[model samples]
Target: MTPEELTRPWPPPTPKPAERGAPPTPVPSAVPRRRLLRWAAVGAILVLLVWSVQGTGVSVGALIDGREGGLHLVRGFLHPDLSAAFLADVGSAVLQTVQISLTGLLLAAPLGLAGALLIAGNVGAPGWLRGSARAGAAFLRGVPDLLWALLFVATIGPGPAAGALAIAVHGAGLLAKLGAEQLEAIDPAPVEAVRLTGTGRAATAVLAIIPQARAGLASLLLYQWECNLRTSTVIGFVGAGGIGQELAISLRLFRYDELSTLILAVLAMILLVDQLSRVIRRRMGAAT
Candidate 1:
């Protein structure tokens, strides 16, 4: 290489683009907004907590202060009266509870399905029919089962029948609302296609909508069964008839041990039903 060639600006010394220090990091899309949102949420929760504490006038700490009493109450479970006669009575009451629950569900299922058909917009029912269905559901749901039980108790007298009727009406309303919602959310393509074939409304619903929502509706029915079971025990106090009446008697007498046994039985039943529901859902899911 010649000295002159070396001295010549070699490929014209490309002036290192005047070092503009470090390149600025671009801000993320919503970092500040997210941070602001996070703080806002935290503040809202703290405010709610404070409001609850002030409004309720019940300090959360006080709940723990009764640890000794709580333990004493819980320990009463140990002395549950297991006499044959007591158990027999309990069994009878339990049967009553089951009878009310199952009977009510039976009555509710069909009524709810009918109401759902009327309520479901996809069913293409007349506007007046839909409105009537909505009104009926609202009426049923708005009135608690206890109130219904009272009405039945007055009209037909107190028994499992009254309880069944009460729960059935309430369950019908709930099922109707839920079923309608489920039908509403279903894909319209199949229904439209069925309609295109000159199918009747009933045929279209059975083929398209009902099939799509059958599984979901069945699950809802099962859940309602569980709810009705629990509720029957409660309505028993109102003389709708069940072990709840026995429970009230026991409570009146302050038979804590008996109460413990009854409570445990109820708890066991609920847990068993819950487990069964989970199993059913799992099996259904697998089958589907």
Candidate 2:
């Protein structure tokens, strides 16, 4: 080799094809197709949003025109009734609501856990049994808690019992579905190892599966309790008995101040439950 060639860089940069007087490589068709699909999806979403807004009669102008009425409502909410007698009644109703939620959760927990065990794929339950349990859970979930409350009220007469039963029936379905998913997501290795130790099917599940999934199951139950508490309040509107009944009465009598008090109570209950659930979940995660 020549002296200049030997002194040159070991790895030299190559010139571009265009610089070499050659045509650029053609772009792939798939790239343009993907971009087209993305734009189409965005356009479809925009169209659906516009259609929904028009169908729902959403109007900023109407909202602006009703400002006075809105302000009046706001003022009433800001000035909740705090009389001693009313406060006593409110406290009682709140307690009843709590009772209903607890009763429902107690009834639902075992039923839900059993259903979850049956439906979980890794549990080795009979296929038919799993399918049946899943179907039953679906049916329960399909029927709203309000409808359940209505049914119980018609059959057993209106009271806290009806509300509790409604919450239980609906919550069982939710818990079963959620718990099954959690169980299915657990580490299969532990389950397999437990089985190899001559443990029976049920024993294996008890020893291996449940322990791993317990944290998730506990969190689900807490969430369900929060939901049950909210549902108990609403079921009272149908005469099932709770703070919701009082809310309905207040609204019918144009007792906006009382209504405001009930709303605040509900909000406070929700916040308390949320905080408690958060703390429990944090502690569980730390323990795990």
Candidate that scores best on TM-score: 2
The local distance difference test score of each candidate is: 0.89, 0.93
TM-scores, each model vs. reference? 0.77, 0.85
How much RMSD separates candidate 2 from the native structure? Answer: 5.6
lDDT tens digits by residue: candidate 1, 1-288 = 888888997577654444655566776789889999999999999999999989987876777997876776667777898989988888888888989999999999999999999999999999998999999998999998889988999999988899999999999999999999988888999999999999999899999999998888888888999999999999888888888877887777877789888887788878988899889988987877
lDDT score, candidate 2, position 165: 95
Name model 1 segments beyond 4 Å from true: 1-72
**Candidate 1 vs. true structure, TM-score:** 0.77
Ten contiguous residues with the weakest lDDT in model 1: 14-23
Off by over 4 Å in 2: 1-28, 286-288
TM-score of 2: 0.85
lDDT, candidate 2, at 65: 94
